[model samples]
Target: MKSLLSLLLASLLSVFSLPGLAQTPEAQSLLASVLALKPNAERGEAEFVAQACSACHRKDGSGKSAGNTPRLSGQHGAVIIKQVLDIRSGLRHNPPMQPRVTEQSLSLQTLADIAAHLQALPISGTIAKGPGSGVARGKELFAKDCAGCHGANGQGNQATFVPMVAAQHYGYSLRELEFIRDGKRGNSNRAMASLIKTYDQDDLLALADYMAQLPAPQRK
Candidate 1:
């Protein structure tokens, strides 16, 4: 009986852990690029606020406490650069950023500079989604703050800077929201920054759950 139980547990653990352990080379490379980023605070921060990133993100980098916009402050530099590249090159899937890009409101160089800056800020906290009340509140907040950009189902705009928030890690998402709110992660779209500004802690956590539940983005 004991041998059978041990075997069962081992199998389960392997099934669960294989993906993380067997990350594709591409995945490892991409993650490595993101992790290697280092922020040039003085230059980057100045660039961040000057680029009008502060308008919607607020002066602190915390957004409106709601919306589909991502937080950038204190984020990995690699992630910021990757996202900026996506937005500038029209690789971002989120639909909303296309219009702004068309207007040349955010230039590719500006995106890079801002991305470098945002990666320097500190990470923020997320609101927890408890068993009962937290879930309900999270839903309400998601509807009010995140639906338009994130979609009701958290199917984010993939073409633009908007990411597919669903199925993301909660801690990552939580910190991401904080960066957006603080102007560390956003600014390319003033409208998005405005939307993100509405979120608070609890609202952020709820958003994380909603995002985590979403389907992962399809490979191109």
Candidate 2:
């Protein structure tokens, strides 16, 4: 009984502690600088290759579904910038991405350019999807809980720095959603964390599947 109580207390502490871990001042400043610069997609294309980002994310930023990489094509530049900055600042934990995105590795201009290039890439190819059984429940949950922030079609808002979830890889989405729900993702939005805190594994599965099946937003 004592061990059980201790474990429960530790769990609560972990959850509460995560809220303070994200968005360092340095990260925010860097994000602002990156966002202010005019991105050169042409330069970005070259940089992306030079940086070996294509090795995992692919040349087109479609990401590797089997590798559990989130699709970056057509995602908002602001969203991408913020995530990169967060990872660099250690506000977000991505072991594989950490060394590659260090300050010495990516200049503000290069980061901006990379973001632009990825955002402009068209989402294509076969995205990994979940089992069809949960899609209906997922759709219903998204409409009720996620549509307001992520848009009805899951086309995330650029100005708000929300990511486009339409057609994202199912495995990646589910993994991230689970991380967010469990307070394991340090950079998670507070409101989003709160909203999903009570969600179970089944709920997360449905949500990921529904988002995965949504059509990719048409880029202008």
Candidate 3:
């Protein structure tokens, strides 16, 4: 009985202690800067195209391949700003994205605009299918482990800057999940890493498929 109580207390603490559940100082600063300027979705669209974001993310911000690059459509502007800052600051180690941050000569305003444009776009589209067997298992795992942070509908919690994962490409989601699970990605949340460690390759694929099949909620 003592052990059971201890375990429950530990679990509760873990939930509250997850990183990025609140905005960091850097993230808060970035959000302030972006908000200080008026976001122009039109300018953001031009900047996104000029930066060749469309090449990988597609013109609509829907990702190109399954389980690979994530769909950015309908993602919150604040989330986009935070990720851009993370990649720039090396908190997130995405090699391809690093150059865009450090060498691309894009200003903070451009980044803010791009984020606004992406957020304004709707996340409607067809997603690639995953193996049939793993989808059900994935749903179960997501409900048990992912939903608390990502939301029941996978819409993500904007207040915390969690990216929306619903209707994303399966291949992209799978690759990222693998990276986070394997500890290959930097700036990953410890709670997510711990949860993902229990999953095998098959489990990752299943979870990806389930998330990919989830419908995107209407933007408020």
Candidate whose TM-score is highest: 2
Tens-digit lDDT string for candidate 2 (97-138):
989999898898999899889888889777898987899999
TM-score of each: 0.40, 0.88, 0.84
TM-score of 3: 0.84
lDDT of 3 by residue, 19-106 (tens): 6334465555564566556678999999999998898889989877745578899997767876787788777879888888762577
Off by over 4 Å in 1: 1-39, 99-109, 124-207, 210-220
Error of 1 at 43 (Å): 2.3
Local accuracy by lDDT, each model: 0.52, 0.82, 0.78
Give the top-scoring candidate (lDDT): 2
Alpha carbon deviation, residue 216, candidate 1 (Å): 22
The stretch of ten residues in a row with the least summed lDDT in candidate 3 is 4-13
Q: Tens-digit lDDT track for model 1 on 1-220?
A: 4442244334333432343223334533443343334435676677677766677655555444454444445443444555554454454444555555432575445554566666445534342222243556667777876787667766554222244454444555766677667766533344555666776677767666665445444433
Work out candidate 1's RMSD over C-alphas: 14.7
